[model samples]
Target chain A: MQMTDLPPAFVLFAAAALLAFVRGKARWVIALAAPVLTLADAWAIIDIGASTVVPFMGYQINPVHVHAATPVFATIFCIMLGGGMLFALNQKRQVELPAAFVYAGGALGVCFSGDLISMFIFWEIMTLGSTVVIFSGRQEGSERSGLRYFGLHAVGGVLLLIGIVIVINQRMYAGEVDPLAFRHFHEMVSGWTSLSWESLGMWLVLIGMLINAGAPPFSAWIGDSYPEGSESGSVFLSAFTTKTAIFTLMVGFAGTELLIYLGLWMALYGIVYAILENDMRRILAYSIVNQVGFMMVGIGIGTELAIDGASAHAFAHIIYKALLLMSAGSVLYATGKRKCTELGGLYRTMPVTMWCGIIGALAISSFPLTSGFTTKSMIVAAVSEQGAVMADLGQSHNHLIVAWFLLEAASAGVFLHAGIKFPWFVFFQKDSGLRPPEVPWNMRTAMIIFAAFCVLLGVFPGPLYEILPYKGVAAKFGATVYSFEHVMQMLGLLLFSGLSFFVLLPMLKRTETISLDFDWIWRKGVPRFWNEVAMPILQTLNRAQKAIFDFFPGAGSESRLPPELARRIGTNWAVSVPVLTITMMLLLYLVVYFVVPMLT
Target chain B: MSDPIRKYLNLNDPKLIKWYWIVGLIVLGIIMAVDLAVHHHAHFAKDGIDIDTTPEFYPLYGFAASFFLVIVAKTLSIALKRKDSYYADD
Candidate 1:
């Protein structure tokens, strides 16, 4: 196969291998060039058709193909990787850069995967890569956190595999064409309310994607694992996994009604947890869930505009979230502090970092003339527009109305938690006496690149809208995205929320503490039960067994045992003895039955 | 790290802090006033939820919602908050 004909992910993988042995300036060249090469490879296959297919086990698996949403997601993934690599140029941890490349490559690979098997393979590869990035943090608790991260994704991967197998088997049984093809589950959209056995495979697949999407009950994993990564490692962690899940959900289970409720829950859950969080990175981590929740709602709405909104929002979110983390990561890099309780007043020395951070904060809050305003409003508009359609059909549309109000409230809450809380505590709160110098040039450059994109995309959204899955819908919405009323509404809401932040500032005070999340079940509750409850009972059972043995003849614990008894209790055994005894018994039975019958 | 830039970016300066509050509040007032003049077509007008279209509804909702969320979080924190080392001790 021609070099260009290979899967785009292979370029990054090759770089990763070279990075393992290569050192010095050569590492930098590979790190920077790989992402650019992958970007070119990604953009080259924008046409929606099979580009590369490999036969395996009598089935075709296309590893290089474009879906409708591929162009936008692929473009952003490449850009993120490039920006992330630049930010990490000074990172001394060798494993981190290589791991990050593999992670980004896996995400890009998913964007081009045309079949379920290929998607699952890339999905697991992402899990492996991200776990290493977390491990490469070399933080005190990183190893444990990385294990937990891997464990959760492993379970999620298994669920996805099971679902894919069931789905492919059912398709084959029904003699469907291209049984392995990864596409929308129209049955999920049509029979959204039903939870029958026939649709169990699709349900498993949705749950698997939802777990990675940071949906509730499993959402705590985002906060639990992401913050443990090194500064730059967390930036890479924030971009790929959740957004890839969003891409998969949009493609596979777009109109599932359940995502609406789950998404709304995640949106609010993230805000509450973030408000109470003191760790700056943890706060950003929670907000990732909150942001993904908005994308989930759009996917649930599943109109052409809503799908476009979800895709466009993911594209914008990856950049701004990375920018936010880069700012936070810069702080961590400069001061070795990730807690707001311990960090403040570095903006004096780090003006570039501060301004970039503030820009990210504003964009996240969806302030007018920022990336969020132009992108997130589309999801909100999609909700109300869908409500109108439902009303016209005389179906129950109350839920859509509620979704709209909750989303608006969430927009304001995003301002409260991330937009103001992150910058306010980390940069402007009570001075913790830290006067660290600005982060290095590479990090600043990365932040500025992303910050510029945030503003430019907001001011001119036409280019981004042009690459959306439903370009017509997105373009039409782009025209009204900056409408006078919408701008006023967003401004009024966000500013007043800023007011609320200061008003409730006393309650929102940072403590050197963490609020309990659902993860406590595994992190504390299960282990506690095993140690405190189950272990003692098993020990007692062992004692009781020993007591019974003590009462038997020549088997008493205090007595000198015979050779047979000693062999049994002392764990002495020979494989040939047991085999010989059983063989002799079987032969005797055989002789008595067969020979005596012949003599009679 | 230099003197000129530090002076501009430093919120630790009492003078700068005062200006920040004053400028922030003024911006808030302008936004609220502008919002009152803008007509918001009700998003769920077909469903008769015209309260959403009322003058300055978003600003009010924004304030109340955030206030409520902070209050709820603080209350939950009383029971749920643990020292950051809670898991690390394990």
Candidate 2:
């Protein structure tokens, strides 16, 4: 069979299934090699033209379609999996490896998905895989956080599924030939002002993707759950979810105006919350939202150059973000501590981790020779480029103007909050007198590989630009990325931001406090409402019902029921009684369905 | 545990801390000067005032924005900040 016949995702999924039955070093071989095999298969199929579509369940589903953005995202995803698995080599959590495979598998599945139905399936699969990964943490309260994460994603998945169904049905009614095609929603977005079924469907689809992208109101999930994972698990957790959402957003909702506002909010929101955070992983998690904001802004611009900027940034982001998390994970793995308050003075002993961490930090900050400098510059340039074109056309593009200023401000904020904060506090701040040994060889190797990529990509971004959706646009932008004017501009902004950090050092002192977020409403507010208001009312109603029921069957007869039945009904009567009542109602419905309708 | 990296980067050493800031400030000054040598392009010139085209615009803006974000976060912590154990019972 042709390589196209076997979707690359299936390779990882099958490996995940196999990992469950394997033991010892054998499991490592399979887990580590799974990504390599899948990448090889992915490249083979991508090299062949177009998509290989097959009829599945009465509809055409091209499960192995490679879009322009697909190659870059898929490449990083495989690289991330390989690096993450390497970091995970020594962890004893047996279930984590398989779960990670499942998660990465689903992420890969979406990269090749050619239809809405297939995309939704892979989306849900990713949710399941990631939820299991969180649960695999098995630490205090991990179960609850995993459940909440799963519940929120399930809600998003339902919204997406409902949207897909609506769009499909509407398209069928309109006699559209390709009703279930998963393509850009430029048409639907342009007509959004006119209320119609298709527009509503598209809006639902956008919201669904945004939720996964860590947009506001639901942005708390990233910080809340990611830190809950085992050290390696968090590294694995960091890579796939939001980046996948970004891929879909770049694909489906590119150029949509609303994304610009939502993206800017996340950018500032991430910096603010990260500045206030104590947990190392949580800080990185918030910054993920912040960084994704850049990509979203690029996608919102929707020009060929802008989309390429977003795609190339996604590629760079995955590597450096993973590198950042890997180093953080190394610290967490070594000290068994994730709090910045407890972590310090590690530059001495863990030199490998320290330097790797520094490299990651600089890269993340878009330091001159780091991967972030080359890649993130493109997104900023795309904005300016788009702004220039819009001005030439003399269109009303005030939003573009505001977006550029805020994004620039936010870029400096990124360095201040994450770039400096992460490495300084973890490595050089006041000596906590905790000298944890360097991480294992495998983990160190993983960090170095990614660290090297960060600098290499920054120095020479041609390899990355060549794979962007618009090749010429990205290639041209890459040529100017390292120009003396641009590099000097970036350095001036970032270094001054660094100077501000030292200036505000006293004000930036770590406090062992969590900056409460929107999740507090659901995690605390909703539960408190249920306990204080809703539960009390229900309990009152229950007491009254019990008083009436106490008088039923003469009370004596109720007490004289069969011992087994009475025992079951007595202690748990509140729950069992409703269950029995519901069962009787179902029996009545069944009787009516068979007998009453026939008699009528 | 004769670790050499500690001796090299140890900020705890007052002398090193002194040199650290000195070098850091010098680099910042040099970069700010270099900004004058290069022509700054305005990203959104037509709609907005040309604040970006000025020499040292990036440096001043970066410092101001970074400082502002921290002050704002600290202010927000007054209301949103909770004890680390706030969610412990969860």
Candidate 3:
């Protein structure tokens, strides 16, 4: 019954279960109060050193524990949940709220889980919660996209579970104490080049996390499904999954050498795909991949400063990305259109939304006076800091050097892809004559609060920097982050990049077309294969089985029974197909269990 | 039905659009000058971080990289572009 024993995740989960039965004003009150209460309880636990262990399954597990980085991620998650729920206040989708609770609940569970078993259980819960949220979009193809989203995450979840089992077994075999303890993967990430059992387990774990973080080939899920959500569903969708993956990566795979290469590819990949993309939400979705890439490089750098940078960047990113999505959602709610080709010249009517969208865009581009500047700058600085350390140590840190320049270049590209491009096209491009008013007050209020945070955190980053993993390192870098020289450099780079957009204005024209991506493999390739190749083979096999059965006389079972008796039985219990299937499967399994033992 | 806000924001007007570009050019010029006045030091330069110490290194890289990304995306469009309905059937 102790406050310390209650993991923050369960708090929302309890609320979710409660929320399903509540109606009207009571529901709204609970939605807001759940996060507020969880935040209060979470902060209390944090104050009590955040160490609370429970014994389950013969393991003493710490489900609510804090690392140096935990506070930063946990804080933003609470803030994001609060703001997201507020934005969704007026949404009539009955299931979206409770589903969001479960989604956020699961991610929160992962944040506090102190063991691999606990983490895996929570991770699967998140996949279910988010898939339901996508299905609740109720748009065209919502169910289908939700299915694909479910399928991909299910694959990721299986990889994670298998990795967890292997790593735990390996640790136990090595005679380690507390073998399932969730701690940093220093051995696996730092020494991945040497192939071994531990490294393979860790590599599997890393791949599983990479899939959620929207790292390439898998990056299409964000764009594919996020935009399909009901406007508010997307706001909730944008916050949890990828950012949680970043949190896990920062915790586990910091300093993994290959991440820098993967991160750089994501950075460029985000920009290129966004440029070719015609839908506004898809553009933002690509940029989410892009921003997460920045955080990945920071973790890959693996310095205290870099880790802090990654954590803080994740903190800042959730708010702004959600804010951007909120603005896009606002547009969708008002206009019922989501493509750039269909939206324009509404800045006159929707000044509040336009300004909020602009603020979010600027913050994402790391404009000097926004949260992106205060936070993302640390990661950029971390690369340089790590490069310096590497040079002094006489180690091969050329990757750090390459990473720093690519990051800076990517920063410029952010301005092009998201900063100006999002606001410019959606709000002020051609006059499509759609004159939607500003979004409703609750939605506007949410956007404004987040927009204010974007600017406030930029101006005063002390609160955020204080909570970063290596608190002192981030605090020290905070001063340099806003130096006149650095600010000028960022302005020069981004503003000029803005000019490049205008220079390429004619080339950047909107079209009702989508550029190909790795998703083509799944969305088109898999279905086509199933239709053209697999289905035909299966149909032929089916015909052959039917022919054999037709020739087999009474062995074809139905022929042995009277047709009238069979028809009577079928007609009587046709609704019990699932029951019949389960009974047969259970009988088969039981037979296998007994016979296998005898055979052995 | 004249909207005052639209009147102020309509850069589609030729004169207003001209002024917008002119102001933008002036602002970029001013910021470029500001970069000159500040003594920019490279975080990695003391440890032999060479290329970044060059004057306006970030600016040039930013411009070139953005330009490069745009051109690449455009080129990719020629091959990768499909009608918006390409996946609608699925």
Candidate 4:
């Protein structure tokens, strides 16, 4: 069949969900096969130019305009889905394979969706799939985290739905019928001279995309719950949700100046928290926010070069980050340990896992000859260029420059904490005396493939660069003055930073504790303080009000009973009735006095 | 010995696993030097031409920096390695 004649990805999504409803190993096989087939279908139709607009069940489903940028994202999501399934195969009892498949398939649907309505449908499906994944953890805190994760994502989905409705309404009012086409959707929504429906529509879309990107204040849900997922489930949780938001941002809100600062804040926040964290998976989870922060900054810059950088970084990050999580998952699987203090000298037995983890760490740190170096530099370089050209932008440009530097510094810090610190403590430090066998070959192979890609992209970036959206606009993959300087600076920074780590080595050792972050507000402080202190105070005040009401007996002729009985019965009536009467009488008296004086 | 010198170069104690420190530093230093001399100038450009940073200086700087770092880390590790349960149980 021609590529244009292909079926919608959502059909495959439904198939996966149906397969998940089945029992046993057969379900697992179906779950695994679904993503592989979906990936193949995506790859085949990625270059198809024709728009296939099918109206199904009162909604328009259009597979149109498969661009270079979108496919890169879709391709990575496919790869992540497949790898995550393989990693979770042994742990499939925690969550049925079909659920994971459906969840991953929903992400794939988001990738191929060509218009706003289709995007919103797939967006909610992605949220539901992820919440289920979190729920499957069945841990002490998983339910609450899952609920918060659901609540925040639902808010994002509602805003996206509102934005889509406004856009559709405006198009209908203008007598435009084609559902597949939106020529400059942002411009269309923003072109209104007044703060009308269109402007509201634009802001709604922007806010929706921002929430998905895990922008601050709303960003706490991710760090709160993601690490609480079942070991392998967290692997699936890591790949899609925020990156899909980033993908949407790339589609809808690129070049919006506000995102640059928002992205910068996320980058720094992740670094600060990750540095203080002792939980292995939560550390990795924060690093996800940090990596996505780079992509956000790139999107905010909105140049062809910057967008390509964002796209490439997302692709690289998903693989390496998943590999990192899988490594942690394997350790968690073997030792029943997720905190760093409970883990050490694992490399003695789990050498393969440790080395794979190191590769992931190196990639995340943007070390030269890893995927991160090739992709992250594009965004940094774009910011530097912006700084040089737009001098009059003044504080904005300075802020961008500072953000870029903070991002770089955070990269070094990530290397210190997650990269070197993680593997060094978990795998190579003083022995924990637990000699768990190496992970299964399938898990190892999955990790090795991702690690190999991290190195491959680092060494030979040409293939990846050629497929980027801004392929023609950015510097080609060759020797340049900036590239040379970048290499020197990277090497120097790594060396100096490594030296500093050694110098500070005495203080860098693991501790038997968890560091506080945003989650602490909900996890320990507010709930405890409110339950122990605030609730009792309110209860006491309520009782005091009741006591006052019991003591008072007011004027109505129902004083026929004994005074004690009257006080007891009338207390209930007296408090509310007298208060209401006194309030009304005071109002009436004031009105009469003022009006009478004025009339005289 | 003075504390600063002892911290940087106390490779005398056999119980300290000082050999591990020495071997790690030597291997890292050699690798850094070789990488500097041979691959220092390798780079990529937009026109697809491979070029060196300055034909002479960048690699030397990289090698020296890398060597110094590896040695320092190795030395520090030797100084810092305590009983296996130093922080584990505490």
Candidate 5:
């Protein structure tokens, strides 16, 4: 079929079957083909620009007219889907292939969706598909994690629906017959719009997106669930969901001020929790939040440079994060262990995996000659320029400076914990006698491809810069301050953190236990408090009901009692009936006497 | 054939330790040389490109001082490895 003639939904439907039917070599080919096909479709649709049409509910969904930013995000989503699919090809599980493809398609659907209603429809599908991917781990922990994951996402979907309804209703009240025909993208981009029902719609949409991005409170679910997924399943889990939220945020809420603070909090929270974590995967999961925080902050800054930085960071982060996780997953797959304590000395056998992991780690930490450095520098430089401009107005820009500094500090922490700590402890530290062979060639090939991109983007950022929405920022070669300062800061962090780890090394070791977080409210505290406190109250209520039933058997029983005349003798019946009738008449007389006078 | 250094440091031997230190120093030296020689770009011309000596130069000086502090901190970690698996028992 001609590329333009191929509908996006058609691609999804085809991918679904391809993912379901294939196994072994056939499965690998199907996995690889699905993404390639999706990418091609994405490119074709994006180029045609609202020209490509598909029928949904009797309405023609023109993807080309969907808004300028949608295509950019859709393009990246396609790339990530392809990369993640390739990464998962070597794993034996059949379920993850279909689950991941459906998940990717749902996200693409969201990106190309022209209206709020279409966006909400695809949003829920993405949630269900991702939840299934998590559950496919086939572990008890995964089952529980999947439940929590779905619960939070369901709530987010509800909130998003409410907001969409409100916005549509307001549009209707304003005399617009079709809410979907309203184009608010220009207003959001201009930043001059006032707060109204429409703006409230924007806030609701932002919260919904942040929930997926793993923002705090709601953030715990990503860390809780993604790590519990099967080694291969996690590769799927990592790519689509959070990045999709970021894509939405970029399109819908860029330049909003609240996102800046939210992003900062997420960045710091990730760093703090990661520092306290012992499980290798959880640490990486937290780092995902940390990395997304940078993008969030960039989107919030709203400058052309800042948005560009955010976009570039998202692209870089997806590749490197997946690479990191795959490396960890390989270790888990090979050794059947996930904790840092139970792992060591595998670098001898898994040197290829080790090096691949380190490259990913370095890229994540924004080391020079890595994708992270190329992209993240744009955000920091944008912040610096903002500080300079604000300083001329006689206002303090200390907060901006501090935020930038914290970002730098977090970068150091990433290297200390993830970059160096992961590879060093799991592969090179004290020996644990593990001798698993190198990972399957397909897995290694995926890692190598990602690692190559990490370097390629870092050494040459021009391609990314060109595609970025932001136009003003300068991200090019030969800037010494950017490179030198970041390197020195990273080194300093390493030195200090290294010293601290040694000083507290006695306490830093992994244990055969889980660390508590917000999930603790559900996992331990709530359950314990209920058993010790709420359960007794329930028991008391149960006992009272039982006592009431026992005391008045017939009162609560099914059988009816005989009438008074049947129970009594004839004389007794005559006297009781006359007495009862007289009592009723007298009571009625008394009621009339007292109640009639009072009414008057 | 066991080496004396292996017994003390629990590393491979004196040969390995010497090699590790040599390689590390060589890498560090190369990085420093590159930083000093290739990275410098004069912010101002000799007379034409006006420069703020106080505001610009001070931060650079402060950065240099902090950089040395980091190096010293790293040197302290040599005392820190702690008889391997110090926390392993817990």
Candidate 6:
């Protein structure tokens, strides 16, 4: 490999290593300088369209290569790290920043990976780094939450690895020269709606990516684990993992029809859950899923402009989501509170934070002059544009029509749940009799900077548009992004949504409650089933064994059992017993699926 | 050190809140009214789904959609909602 072909991820990796040992002002220097340097290096690589291939186990793997979407995603990942570091500067937990760096480094690494093997490696690195970030939060239950988070992502990573292995093996058998090339799977795009053995690997890959993107069933992990993070640690956590998955999906599975359905579900799911959610951070976490759903729809549309829209939206989403989280983090920093029920009337003492939070809210709602308006509108326009194209082709596009309407409805829903619910409940609702000062200067500076990006990109989206995968398409769309009719429609939708929030205020009252999601299957349902049903059967079986043993001549003499033996057979194994039993069951399943089938 | 914007932004101030709501509602009304004059291009013209172009369609849809979402969420809460500490207490 050439010296100039170094991956920009090394910059953050070096900084993360240094951050582990550095102290005082030097830590700040490394933290601030790392993202800047990484951005420059990333751009240089992107500008050159560089690639460096290394031989790994008899296969050529490009660990450092720029793809079409690299500039936008890599640039935003670097910017997120910088802004997140700024927000986290005052965080006394020494481990968060370094862990955040490693996490972001993995995300950046994924952006430049030109092969599936490298992508999977970086993907797992992200899971590891982010799990550390959660653990470092030291919040109550953060340990268990982090473990749960890690366990889910580990399963996702395994799915992706198995899919990669199968796909590469299939490609090799087919005599393809480059078996591991990470590019759009055009064949699957055509026949994506139905299942076939040939497309099984791609299907596994898509499910794995969807899981990371916070799609259904797996969606609860975002809200479940993110709220357990420290104020700023959650800020860092909110940006990287899902967006990176979005980057991968845009590359590999663009134009797949199923993503549209999944996206629509995620969009509405985020809103409904956020509406019932009482925790302020969880509310924002759900919105992340909601916004990602918009991007997913655009990727599914799979036109040049649509892909551009998804890329641009992911870029803008990261900034504003991080901004929103930072605002919430600041509130938590000042008051040590995270629930909407416990906060209100903070505008009296925390004007900076309140305004920043409001700006983030407006931006997220795609108000007339914010980043969300400039970026997210592209996705909406793409849906209509694609519908028109299908009409010209004389093909029925009923799904596209439904998708357009649902996306529009989701746009309004975003305003209600996140834009109105977040700020109104946290800053302007009935006073909870708490007066907390503004956050420290570093946090305020971070919030202001991100909030400014929201408006700046909204007003003059030229720079952001230029970096999109389809710059010409984005720039052409940017021309009409602020047209009078478009602006008015968005305003009418969002304003009326705001009105709805007030109109339905009584029904939307905050409660100290959590809504059970699909995770309830594992978190509550599985444990309950084991304890109440499965354990009883196992106990009976054990008792039957003991009875049979007592029937033996010598066994009857020792029926009382030794203390060690009794403890081993005890009923109260807390978590380990169920965990072990489940593990063994999974092992049996593996045996039945692979070894037994092979023998047959 | 003083927060001057608090005087107007504070929700606790009755007069300010009353005027704010009046202005906000008027803005929504004006946007809806303007919908009568402007012709919204049909997004799915080939599919003949031009209902989106009707006057005040956006505002009406926005209100109804959010209302539906809130009601649906509340109904779901009846079955799925639990004390925030449900998991922790276990």
DockQ, every prediction: 0.71, 0.74, 0.63, 0.06, 0.07, 0.75
Model 6 clash pairs are none
What DockQ does candidate 6 score?
0.75
Fnat across every predicted model, in order: 0.77, 0.87, 0.76, 0.01, 0.00, 0.76
- Pick the winner on DockQ between candidates 3 and 4: 3
lDDT of 3 at A152: 95
Candidate scoring better on TM-score of 2 and 3? 2
Q: Which stretches of candidate 2 lie over 4 Å from their true place?
A: A193-198, A543-563, A566-600, B1-5
Name every residue pair that clashes in candidate 1.
none
Q: What does candidate 4's lDDT look like per residue over A1-600, in tens digits?
A: 464455346546666657756766776676667677776777667655445677767867775447447678877887787788778776646454455666766676766677777777778878888888888887656887788788778888898788777877777778887643433455632342355655677678778878877787566667667887887788888888889888878877777777788888887667655655567888888878888888999988887878988999999999899999999989988888887778877766787798899999899888899998888888877776666556544443656656655565656555665677677767766667889998888788888988999999888887777768877654463334236556655655555455455556666665544443454465567777999999999989768755755555653445345668767776434335556558879999999989989998
lDDT of 1 by residue, A233-329 (tens): 9999999999999999999988888888898999998999999999999999999999999999999999998899899999999999999999999
Regions of candidate 4 where Cα sits further than 4 Å from its true position: A1-8, A11-15, A21-29, A56-68, A92-96, A166-198, A391-396, A474-484, A519-600, B1-90
User: Model 3: clashing residue pairs?
Assistant: none
Per-model TM-score versus the true fold: 0.92, 0.93, 0.92, 0.76, 0.78, 0.94
Off by over 4 Å in 6: A1-3, A547-600, B1-4
On the 0 to 100 scale, the lDDT of residue A34 in model 1 is 90
Q: Interface RMSD, candidate 5?
A: 10.4
Error at A553, model 5, angstroms:
10
Clashing pairs in 5: A49-A64, A50-A64, A50-A65, A304-A470
Selected candidate, larger DockQ, 5 vs 6: 6
Clashes (backbone N, CA, C under 3 Å), per candidate, total 0, 1, 0, 6, 4, 0
Model 5 chain B lDDT-worst window of ten:
B43-52
What tens digits encode model 3's per-residue C-alpha lDDT throughout A144-197? 889999999999988988888889888999999889888889886657789776
Question: Model 1's A-chain: what TM-score?
Answer: 0.92
Error of 1 at A174 (Å): 1.5
Over B1-90, each residue of candidate 3 has an lDDT whose tens digit, in order, gives: 247866868867889888989999999888877776778777677556567667767777788989999999999999999998888855
Check candidate 2 and list the clashing pairs: A371-A454
Residue A63 in model 2: shift from native, Å? 1.2
